[model samples]
Target: MNVSRRDEDGPRRVVVGVSGSLGSLAALHRAVAEAGRLGAEVLAVLAWEPPGGEFGYRRSPCPPLLAAVRDAAAGRLATALGEAFGGARPAVPLRSLAVRGQTVPVLVGLAGRPDDLLVVGAGRGLLRRGLRPSVAAGCLRQAGCPVLAVPRPALQHDLDALHRRHFWHLPEEPVPAR
Candidate 1:
């Protein structure tokens, strides 16, 4: 699905990867806000892999299935953009693309231009390194352009909520006052 498009020769773009995760949405928000400030465009790219097997970042061997998957992913990107911006479109031009591939490779590809700014989310689970690296971490390590890895909003985490509740409900110690 396409988001928005402007002249090809426009200024550099702020490229963002959205995977429907809370962290990705946060990164999208940051990208849009930053793009507005810089008078740049937002290139929102969403990547999707098929249900099974490793289909490298090329034309899907099975086009029919891949088409359906791409459709779903694009639809998701649209919904996510709506939610992230809350009807407040960015001041700068915005374009969204849904491509098939792993997040890191697709985003790294998009950031090939020297002026591109890549933004990704940074909420890999604690201890997740053994299992896998986050897309944000991977892109930051490999991409040629500057990368901004925005973690999901702190308030979205359970620990933060628990801390807020605990603080609000704390028992007060009575003190004798003269």
Candidate 2:
């Protein structure tokens, strides 16, 4: 016999992973839209790990520094939320959290309800290691709920291209095709 548990977590949630990147902002917007469409609440989650990973922190733990890092993570989450919504509240109910852990696990664990929806950005930037598609992939494999991977906004792609050109000191105007 199968036992089904009731979700005590009020409304279904559109759980989004936010990292303050343009891609993440795009995901956040998509999540809000989904929440509105589904009459669900929006749960914006930002995950952070201590500098140099857990092993590094364990080797030389500093409580004060750890506190500062955690505080910074919370501040970044607040800033990302404001930037994502342009300081205007979303029409849907919204809740924000900044947790200390691996991103994929944190997201998957929080969005464990069968009705929950997990949203993640699909890319990062040209000059960086970029969005770990693995986050979305991991969620897809592990989440009990549906996963929505939002593609990076076109503007982000353009900005990344411009950044790439600037990094290489290339002329802004491309050479005319022969």
lDDT against the true structure, per candidate, is 0.83, 0.89
Candidate 1 lDDT over 1-178, as tens digits, reads 5543334445788999987878889888899888988788999999878867464424447778777888999999999988888878777799999987778999999878767899998876465656876787789889999999897787568775696799899999899898
TM-scores for candidates 1 onward, in order: 0.76, 0.86
Write one digit per residue (lDDT tens) for candidate 2, span 1-178.
Answer: 6544534557778999998988899999999999999999999999998898789899999989889999999999999999988899999999999999999999999998889999999855433445344687788889998999999899988997887788899658887999
> In model 1, which regions exceed 4 Å deviation?
1-9, 55-62, 127-129, 159-178
Residue 52 miss distance in model 1 (angstroms): 1.5
For each of the candidates, give the backbone clash count. Answer: 0, 0
Worst lDDT run of 10 residues, candidate 2, spans 124-133
Instruction: In candidate 1, list every pair of residues with a backbone clash.
Output: none
Which residue pairs does candidate 2 place in steric collision? none
On a 0 to 1 TM-score scale, where does candidate 2 land against the true structure? 0.86
Cα RMSD (angstroms) for every candidate in the order listed: 9.9, 5.9
